[model samples]
Target: MATIRERAGRWQAIIKRKGYPQQSKTFDIKKDAEKWARQEERAMDAGTWADQSAAMQTTLAEALVRYEKEVTSGKKGADTERVRITKWKRHKLAQKALGTLKASDFAGYRDARLKDGAAAATVRLELAIISNLFNVARKEWSFEGLANPIEAMRLPTSKNARNRLFLDGEEARLLQALAPAARGEDGRFGDGCANPLLRPLVQLALATAMRRGELLALRWENIRLADRVAHLTDTKNGHSRDVPLSSAAAEVLRALPRAIRGPVFPITPNAVKLGFVRAVERARKRYEAEGGKDERMLSDLHFHDLRHIAVTALAEKLPNIVELAAVSGHQDVRMLRRYYHPKAEDLARKLG
Candidate 1:
């Protein structure tokens, strides 16, 4: 049976049914209430009515906290989820309860987020986090009949093309700036001094094209200097991969003192980011001092861009660009293409 009640100047329909927890929803019209109740009844009879209240009772923030602690914390690459959770906490979707969130609510949130200058990629990521949370709720947390609202929603196309890469001269200049900073006097830089890891980090990124997380998680045992290969224990696709080390890359690894404890790159992810920031600052200052335009020298250079440089170099060296895709650990050729660039000689030959 379903009854209509007036509360908070809104018409709320309260339904009582077997196996269905008591459910209520506010509607503007009595007919709408009747229509929804009939639909719900059919769904309930078919054993398809997901307990919306069970899902809705948990707020997005609360769900994320639980997911982070119980689910993400157990994973090997859990830091990425932690970063996503931080972003979600600041998003409007985090304020809403999962049960009360209709498809329209998500649509509005998506639209509003776009209006507020969030990129399609960012919105898509937030949606993914939400969807994953609900999935965990249903499968792990015993929240029955909880439909993922995001399933009914379509996210905009993500702009994920790699537009940033180091040009020939750019890499040389960056290395020249980073080398002295990385190998400072006495092999250890003083506090407030330049990062001691910048050159080696850049070299590894350019040679291997490994993701930042993958690089940071590398262990000393994984680096086989004698074998000339670095065994990556796990990658983004949840597979173990072996990346061959270039001569220069091997030299960089040999130069590094073994970590006393865990990861080869023992610094926290935040520390890596901070080190990158400091390196960028130093590079910018040097560029300006040498009479270069501040904007031109610093234009669109990110730590991740070094991976693009590696992939591009490898693609140009081989006749089949697809061969390098395996080395770069890209599952798809389409993804590999984003980082591939034609060699200048090849371009010249084509022009001729």
Candidate 2:
């Protein structure tokens, strides 16, 4: 039998059953309180009742901390995932207990994030982290009563695929901006980037369709110049592939002074990202100074766009889809199409 009573103008349901832990819940209505008590008592009698004490006690922040230490730390993108976890800790929703969170709460979060100018992809990733955390808790952390609130909510869809390509004279301006000043015999100066590696890095990215992470991870030991191949031991997809080097790509590598640190480009991701942004700004200024009329030239460019440009250019030479997929290391032909954006005029010329 369960006890139902009114306290502080609200009804409270308390169930004290033998051979099981006691359960109590407060409800606004007496009927709701009695209804909950009956259901809980019946479930206990049927041996179908699950204790949600752990989920009810644990907050989202606490769970995220545990997930980050035990799970996210072992992942390849651990640093990135940690950053996301930290962001979640700052949100008001993080204060709520895991069991108290509902699909409506997550839906509101998605709506608020979208209103605040957060990208659909970014929100999707954030929600995915929470969803996965719930799954891990249910499967491994002995929280079988906990439900994934995100599973009931529809995730925001992303349609932000970029097709950014370098315009006429834009590449030249960017390269010039990246180039460091030449030192004379008297220690005089001339035009280029202070870091000698930046130019070659950009050149190699354009020559080969290698991702920024792939380029940064490139090692001299993996290069077989005679065979014109760069062996990648690790890739985004967890599969290794040999990237064939073009004459231009080979020349860029040959000119670079070998680093004793092992990595071909010893720069960190943040360094490359910051350096690329500064170089683009400088290029834009120089382009305008040279009477370049197009406002879009060298504007809104990203380092990752280089991979897309390289893929599109490679499509011209390797017309066969299979051969192009081999070069780009794209396991799916559909994904390859996303990167290969050929100009209509070029296609028309080829048709002629």
Residue-level error in angstroms, candidate 2, position 276: 2.8
lDDT of 1 by residue, 192-306 (tens): 3365676688788887778887898788877788889988888878888888887887888888887644677766677666676676666667778888864756566777777
TM-score of each: 0.78, 0.82
Candidate 2, 51-164: lDDT as tens digits: 888999999999999999999988867766888899999999999999999999999999999999988988999999999999999999998678899999999999769889
Clashes of each: 2, 5
Worst 10 residues of 2 by lDDT: 187-196
